[model samples]
Target chain A: MAQQEFDTTAFRNALGSFTTGVTIITATAPDGTPVGLTANSFNSVSLDPPMVLWSLAKTSLSVEAFNEAKHWNVHVLSQEQQDLSNTFASRGENKFAGIDLEEGLSDAPLIPDCSARFQCRNMVTHDGGDHLIYIGEVLNFDQQDLPPLVFQQGQYAMTARKPWEGVELSSEPKAPECSYNEDLLGYLLGRSHFQMLFRMRKVFDEQAHEDSHFFALSVLNIQANLSLEEINDYIEYTGHSLTDTDIEFLISQELIEKLDDETYQLTANGRETSLLHIAQAKAIEEELIRDLGQGDVMALKLLLKRLISKTDPGLPDLWKAKETAK
Target chain B: MAQQEFDTTAFRNALGSFTTGVTIITATAPDGTPVGLTANSFNSVSLDPPMVLWSLAKTSLSVEAFNEAKHWNVHVLSQEQQDLSNTFASRGENKFAGIDLEEGLSDAPLIPDCSARFQCRNMVTHDGGDHLIYIGEVLNFDQQDLPPLVFQQGQYAMTARKPWEGVELSSEPKAPECSYNEDLLGYLLGRSHFQMLFRMRKVFDEQAHEDSHFFALSVLNIQANLSLEEINDYIEYTGHSLTDTDIEFLISQELIEKLDDETYQLTANGRETSLLHIAQAKAIEEELIRDLGQGDVMALKLLLKRLISKTDPGLPDLWKAKETAK
Candidate 1:
């Protein structure tokens, strides 16, 4: 623990293990200069007194401005404000240039569309070694339903909350020796995906349509006139492929029709079916967001996208390959 | 923002919008008593001078103990430390009971298995209205790769990092008019599940087994002597069921055998094959853990489990239903 052994990079990295919400602290200095910087050190201090605190590096360019400012505003950035965070984090000229300011109790600049806003009067400053800690008495504050942007280990993040009671698919504890217990990631993904489709199965089942037909129509809804082979190339990952009999069935039902040159395209009836499926899918997701909260669903989708990309197996780009060619 | 209009609950809710990592600050009173409590106010202030700060309410039972202490330790809780957080958060007697303590450079009790630990010398203290803010100079620190626990909007959470460049399923932007775009949660979940299974298809394909056989054997691995109807009850959610022909095929391959009462059980060969599939599945998951980092994968699994529980359409518990009956 000697000073010589203090690897500053490693120390900073260790400190980064603490995750935080991104915030933009804004203040209007003397002589009418508006200044702001992005900081994640913000934390709530005293609820009774309604106070909050954050720190700034002593060597920051706006140190004097913050020190002399009578009031400051802390805006917890939303997920869509990453660019604003970057703009304020850097020494960009005119950090507040494009951002629309909302009027607040103090003269401090208030940026709109933050997850939360705290208008505070600068109360006291404390020495924090190479940084200065500013404790502020919160004059007024407001919050919105926007998902707050997160930072963890120097990377931006979103959170999926764990219910205090925990999520258990079964009311019973799984046997300790079972290898195929419920904790498997692959198993969970498969079940989650299938259960979702299982719900939508009712909608398609009522129309006497199999999942393969739904999958093909979905592909055709985006990229028209695909031969059976080309359509199979996209939906084969679902372990189902469209057969000629299935195509005949679709055509008889007027959901799809044969095109010249041996390709098939979705008819107006088919397009309507695909859109209905999409609407049903959207409804399911809306229900999920309502149940799990928007932030949790956004985090789930982000992770799913990342997982899909990481494990992509060179699947054909369903949109890019077809759209750009046209 | 008048005094009467300051709703304490609303103000606290606004403050909760900002996420933070859970921490437990520990110190020993001069009279040989150890004290610690759960906190989320910990934040790093200075990198060069190695300073950090956390605050405690003056009315807290341990506030005087902390104020009188000359040294303290900050342990950033990992995902596994949720129980520890709850333990410290409560007014339980003998908070350190049954917990192992690690030796540190100072008298403060150091906690083990945390995401990170900072041993610090209590340097300066400032009055923050109803709270006392303690700024400390970090003396020693260490970190592990454990996923840190998060607290957001009054719920415990885990973070999934968003890359600097966002995760895009396709190389190009999807057409605005396409209802079949990739952003749909159902689509993402389906694609991710299929792609992962697509990779595992190699292992099972080598044995000339289909995904349906794979799913059936998986259920049989957990519950023995299940009739086709009972087994289908467990796996029909996967949209693939074991047909009578498929069951006969498994019997011919010696992976399963028919019982006198029309139930089926995995033979020795079937058991071996199922175990291999489980191994391959675990290997695939390990690769994902490597690629997505441990935290992100954990978050994904947590969310998936939650979604599965939320959307469960009364699928029979593969383990519990049969085991309890047995």
Candidate 2:
């Protein structure tokens, strides 16, 4: 629809549809004060003489300082720096209070642990209606392996990159009428979960442990001194249960021991076994992070957490403070 | 590190660290020919005047047309438009051949189904090193609910928006020594998988079916007339097996019938039940899509498929053409 009438809110929302990486632009005022603010308007301009540009509202409080500055540093924030973005975006004083600044080419304040940093010399300022556009010549730049933070539709985000050619699990397509296909979310989740557990099972198999025993030990690892019934409560959703025979097998292997109160705890050997399991799990995760970038892994975890919360079956919270105290 | 020597490759890679949404800027050449190219160098400049800016390399083939054009349209590409992004980014002739154009305020070719579209009157063009920056005053704009496509470090991506506060399964922190915490990818996947299944179980309960029977029907739905042993082979990874008792149960329920040579095929009733199960699964997915945006769900599925491929344990391919042929 073509609009002759300008609704500011609608215009802003329309602009927000364009996603961007979060950036914090820092500059040193003539008085030697560091001024910074969060802006997603940063964009790369030229390559030969390397240049970039960003826009700021004319009414911004730091506009004067940025205008007078000869140089500024733009920090392409990493996913871990969302708080830093919020801090600089606000009107709070001492924005750099707890920040450990790093030395840069110019006097502009350099923030550490960014996905990338660009030191630029302010080249020109153009007037655009109610904003000032600052074009800068990149003097120096460096990039890290951190996953850049993303912003779209007024929310922080992490990206899961698609391979250039895309990922396909099956070479052949399923029959059109076959409702159960590879695209089914349930099938994907089930297959992914089982495959991961399959990897963990190799480690468990070495100790002559079954999936149920491993689940039991994992529960004890989080909340110790749980009775058999309590342990089953946590592991029941997995469709695996710890039978008396399985508990006896674990005790024979010295992986677990029962107390007088009918509560079971991991023996020292059991704790070590559990730790080894965790190490294997961590190793598997590292391999996945290597295959999929850090950002994709983070996004997967975020989505999984959301899914878990939404479908929670009222099971006892494993990481709850009250549970830990008990 | 400050670089006095500019390596174009390194500079380009460093610049890529700043992620951006893909856009296709289109304008009709002086001879009434449509010219368009994909660009990521776009950013909002002013709100009061509703202005936006994008930069074009001076060496671009379309530079002459863009320079002389008095109006242009900026389309913020949606995730589904990656193919279109690649098409426009190329030097191919007739980029507008298959594209359905929408009527706009100007002669600029407006593409449909973009995350957003900005029809603008050319405002000013500024010089930035080897690039020419074209600023436009937004005469009209519109936005859609589709998720925007993201680009970072030379790859296309989809974003999973983080809530303003963040997602937490529990309010309290786990013990530092607790090896099993919420961040474990395996634990997250397993929990997410089971929790989703638990919701489906409410629907499954109505049919008086357990998960294994559901798995059996799904396998048969994909490849009909599979023997019990073959079906078990397909579903073994899920810790499910089909036994004579299970086969008899299916027969009693008229969900499946024993064919010659001891192979089993889903009866008409069985196929209908399987379709019902798929519908419920799709319903569950729709609710998830509502909670987590479409892009996030798609990304999760992509990642899960990748994970399944990586950790695949030589399970029988259910969707293999040869199997379907049988």
iRMSD for each candidate structure, in the order shown: 1.1, 1.3
- Per-residue CA lDDT of candidate 1, range A40-139, in tens? 9999999878899999999999999999999999999999899999999999788888777888898999999999999999988888778888999999
Worst 10 residues of 1 chain A by lDDT: A317-326
lDDT of 2 by residue, B1-326 (tens): 45589888988998888889999999999999999999999999999879999999999999999999999999999999999999999999999998989999999999999999999999899998899999999999999999898998999988888888788887677556447788899999999898888888887778788789989999998888788888888898887788899899899999999998789999999999889889989999999899887988988888788788778888878888544455
Task: Give the residue spans of candidate 2 off by over 4 A.
Answer: A1-3, A174-178, A321-326, B1-3, B323-326
iRMSD (Å), candidate 1: 1.1
Best-fitting candidate, scored by TM-score: 1
Any residue pairs clashing in model 1, and if so which?
none
DockQ of each: 0.82, 0.76
lDDT of prediction 1: 0.91
Looking at model 1 chain B, report the run of 10 residues with the lowest lDDT sum.
B317-326
